[model samples]
Target: MRIALGVSYLGTAYQGWQSQPGGKTVQDRLERALATFADVPTIATLCAGRTDAGVHGLNQVVHFDAPVERAMNSWVRGTNRYLPDDIAVQWALPVPATFHARNSARSRRYAYVLLESPVRPSVETGRVGWVFRPLALEPMQRAAHHLLGEHDFTSFRAAQCQALSPVKHLHRIDIGRRGPYWRFDFEANAFLHHMIRNIMGCLIAVGQGLRPPDWVAAVRDARNREIAAPTFAPDGLYFLGPVYDADLGLPRHTPAFDWLPL
Candidate 1:
């Protein structure tokens, strides 16, 4: 039987989502725990997206095929029992054999946070966001508007990105401010490696008067990585959620939702 698992994890302690040669990873731990529950030595899993080190996921999806003997509820409880506190299995359900956590996803959303106060955040140092300088939210919002559509995001992608092409349809890009923090929300069909972080860095530069608003479009047209800003820290980023089509039987949207202004 095929099963789809919804997972949430604190990526601060692990290397990344994929298993590494000698490093601990969320996948390695998850495979080990799943083995214990399945009573098997090998279990392969696929994720909706690969999050870098120190990044977090509020609702990451993974799919795997295992025997029907393992109940959905038992899989959740059993997996949690063996996994560390930082990672938890939120829910598990039987899925169609054709369902996939990655390929089947319709859209992916991500949020990048920034604290715009002089004092650093103590509570969410590595969890929330942190920025010590005053940021002009209006300009940042304006700059983000230029990115809301299909474009080749080569400038915002890492040089080592393995994606076959830089073309992607960016559905939306939003910027908002709440008291001492600024938030950036993005939705797209898919993302390239370090795409969001690099975009955020460019927008921050625009916010700080370090870059012109037109620079965003210029970079896209150039399709050159050398002209783009540095990638932002992974700590302030989150895999907010993924969107699936109604036919998938999964919820169409995440319940804890807030629609950011476009």
Candidate 2:
């Protein structure tokens, strides 16, 4: 039987989403937990998106072929028993064999939460990116406008990114601020590695008056990574999850979505 799970995790302690030799990734822990629950030597899982170290996942979807039949709820409660406190299985469903967690996704969403204050983050240290300087909403919004459509994002992509193409269709970019907190939302057909973080660095630069709004357009057109701002920290990045067809009957968001400051 093919099974799908909605998992969430605090990525601060993990190496990343993919399995590694040290077995310190979220995938490693999850696969081991699934294996233990099924009484099998191993059970591999494929996730809709891979998050980097220090990034969080609000609802990461994964699918694995089960060797034994079990109730859907059992998969949630059983696998979670062996998982760490910071990681958990939120929901589970039976999917058709033709369904793929990654390829079937229509679009993916991400959010970056930033704390704009002279004081460094205390209670929310690893949960938010910090910027000491005050930010202007107008400049950042204008800069974001340049990235709203399909374009080559080589300037924002990480050098290590293995994506076949740098061209991606950015569906939306929403920038909102509530007091000292700033939230940036991105929806796209897909994102290159460190794409959002790289953009964040550029946006922050414009917000701080270090660069003009038109500089963003120039950077985009240049398609040169060196000319753009440095990649921002991954601490505040969150995979809001992937959007799939409604006919598939998958949950769109998890409860943790409400917890974000946005």
- Top candidate by lDDT: 2
Cα-based TM-score, every candidate: 0.94, 0.99
Give the per-residue lDDT of model 1 (tens digit) for 1-262.
Answer: 9998888888889888888986499988888888887888878999998888888877888999985477789999998999999888888888899998999999998888777778887877786666677788778877888888999999999988899989999999878777777778889999999999999889989999998888888988899999889888898888877888877766533432343212
TM-score of predicted structure 1: 0.94
Each prediction's Cα RMSD? 2.4, 0.6
**Residue range with the least summed lDDT across 10 consecutive positions in model 1:** 253-262
Cα displacement (angstroms), candidate 2, residue 208, comes to 0.5
Counted clashes in each candidate structure: 0, 0
What tens-digit string does per-residue lDDT give for candidate 2 at 68-153? 99999999999999999999999999999999999999999999999999999999988899999999999999999999899999
lDDT of each: 0.84, 0.95
